[model samples]
Target chain A: MDNQDEIRKIQLVNQLDQLETISRFLDELAEAWDLSIPFVMKLNLVLEEAFTNIVNYGYQDNETHEIVLVFEKQNERLLVSLIDDAMPYDPTIAPDPDINLSAEERKIGGLGIFFIRKMMDKVSYQRMGSNNVLKMEKVINP
Target chain B: MMNLNFTEVNNYKVVQIEGRIDTITAPDFESGIMNLMSDGVTKMIFDCTKLDYVSSSGLRVFLMAQKNISTNKGMLKVCCLQPSIKEIFDISGFSQIFTIEDSIEYASGS
Candidate 1:
């Protein structure tokens, strides 16, 4: 965590429309770091899934809320931390969807979390005060 | 943001999708494809050559469409998936569920 290692953070409103903005911000960060297209795409997918879950189910009220994302590059791994005050939820504990099941019998609710786990090297969740804190790490193979 | 374009080729409905299909655009993607079911479209090919990305939400939409088409005794084929997008499908086990081909012609033939 060098002071000059380009730590980027963004606060997005809890709305589906903000997905595009989040993607742009991440793309900029990835570009600045010279990350490969495949790596950036995978990171983008992981972030989208997590953010979508928070926007769709995190808050119970009709008002707007802020979801924060922090990104950093550490040695051979990329680290991303998400902080939201919407609810108390731990996606890491969710059961992995049975990928072996046929398409007709497969369930859709859990694939988002399951994909995140499969794409990232490590995923950790914590409750800090009133916010749900999630951290994910992915090793840069290239 | 996502864009879907459809064309008819030899009695097969070919759909070319572009841009990202995340949670924000998946519902529209689902309904757009499902609407074709009403037209009695039995043979379909999805060309993903221009598709930039697909998340879990997108996968759900594809799965739903495949199931619906199967129920109607139709065949759904996907072709020209970019490497990364194909990787997502492979990781999700969707590669086993759908007929994925290398090109539009091959998909149409199948």
Candidate 2:
């Protein structure tokens, strides 16, 4: 909570159609901060994967919910925070598939989190105050 | 968020893709191509002129299509990919495996 750190926040409605807008917003933020190309691509993928899951799976019974995304930059690193009041489902608990499985034998789902874990430098999740909070960060420079 | 359109150009199956090709829509993409393949149409060209995004999943579908077409001795060409999607392809070394062209005419050989 330092005054020197920069923060950007956007509130998203829980719908599959809003995924693209969220990604575009993130891209604009990245450009404004002069984020590198590779870093931007990686961050864009993570945001799309996470938000899609939220829009598809979260609030299955409810028609609407609010998803808040916050972007902060510090020390050449970008930290993205996603807050949603959907059901309590932690991506980390999902089982990781055996990479050795052949294409035909492998299960279809659960690869999104695995890809996110590989692409992003750090990812963490928590449930606080009836909200699911996911925080991910990437270092654009050494 | 994939903006997709299909057209027949110069006797070639052309799929014009736009916007992002991420996890959610990658499966739809794979299915779309598979539907065409199942109909016994093999020679295809992907016109990516307006495509602005692609994830590894999207790349995976391309790899799968390459394999399918190779087994059948059919040609699968990609053309007019924008910088963002092309960057992903280049970084992942897909430029070597697929026949990518600057335009659909080049890919169609006409």
Winning candidate number (lDDT): 1
- Candidate 2, residues A88-118: lDDT per residue as tens digits? 8787677764555433344436656665776
- Tell me model 2's lDDT, rounded to 2 decimals: 0.78
Error of 2 at B88 (Å): 6.8
Span of ten consecutive residues with least summed lDDT in model 2 chain B: B87-96
DockQ each: 0.82, 0.20
Candidate 1 iRMS, in Å?
Answer: 0.9
Predicted candidate 1 versus true structure: per-residue lDDT over A1-142, tens digit per residue: 4667668888888988888888788778877887888888888898888998998889999998988999888777789999999889999999888888887897777888888899999999999999999999998764
Off by over 4 Å in 2: A1-5, A100-102, B1-18, B23-35, B43-51, B56-110
Off by over 4 Å in 1: none
Which 10 residues in a row give candidate 1 chain B its minimum summed lDDT?
B101-110
TM-score of each: 0.95, 0.71
Candidate 2 Cα deviation (angstroms), residue A125: 1.3
The TM-score obtained by chain A of candidate 2 when compared with the true chain A: 0.89
> Tell me, what's the RMSD of every candidate?
1.6, 4.7
